[model samples]
Target: MTHKDILLVEDNPDDVELTRLAFEEANVANRMVVAGDGAEALDYLFARGKHAGRDASQLPAIVLLDLNLPKLDGREVLQAIRGNPATRDLPVIVLTTSAEPFDVEASYALGVNSYIQKPVDFEQFVWAVRQVGLYWLVLNHPRVA
Candidate 1:
């Protein structure tokens, strides 16, 4: 399958820039859609508000989510996605700073495919982003077409 795009839901500007650069360095040709909050992420996914007229079939290959977000949290966002029949099977990876056991368990319970903690070091962060992009965007076999 082709790497179409990735939805990156991150609140921090530095992390967003790093993730964008990492995807570029990894040679990941897919587009990166940045959503600073959970609400925007949902809008992008469902083609609501400013995202109106978006083709629902053009869902991103992966969603990199942060737990702490404005409007709606990552858990609520995950539940919304999974609850919808159209995006139920979409691949969502919880990538956040929190590695708390409760966060990990709750994310998995919400149907997150993978849960990863952000690295503090800049270089390590880049590497982690590359790895995630590679694994989810290329190596992962999706549950649906």
Candidate 2:
């Protein structure tokens, strides 16, 4: 099996840096791809726009998606991902600051694999990332695409 990378869809520079640091602290060796917004994320996944010619079959092992994003929101992104046959089964973990019940329910309804709230404390954030890496990268058995 090919080594799959992780896709992080976020608009915040600080959050992006924090996620990178957290993954490093967890010793997760998988490559990380950053999309500044939902549109970029879609492009990356679909190999369109600037991501043209990318191997569409080489999908990310997991997607850490933020609920609030520019261009298109995370919910819309999730809907698109699930709507497409090529990316319908891709694992998406909604990593955001929102703890609203509606958001959680809607994400599940859209077929998100997991939902995680961003931790305010740096250490907690690292721990959360570590757990995510351990479970999704190390243990989860993904469906054959």
Q: Tens digit of lDDT per residue, candidate 2, span 1-145?
A: 5568999999999999999999999999999999999999999999999999999888999999999999999999999999999999999999999999999999999999999999999999999999999999999999996
Please list the residue runs of candidate 2 whose C-alpha ends up more than 4 Å from where it truly belongs after superposition: none
For model 1, the superposed segments whose C-alpha errors exceed 4 Å read: none
Measured by lDDT, the strongest candidate is 2
Candidate 2, residue 58: Cα displacement in angstroms equals 0.7
Model 1 residue 98 CA deviation (Å) reads: 0.5
Question: Quick one: best TM-score, which candidate?
Answer: 2
Model 1's C-alpha root-mean-square deviation from the true structure amounts to 1.4
- Candidate 2 residue-wise lDDT at 100: 100
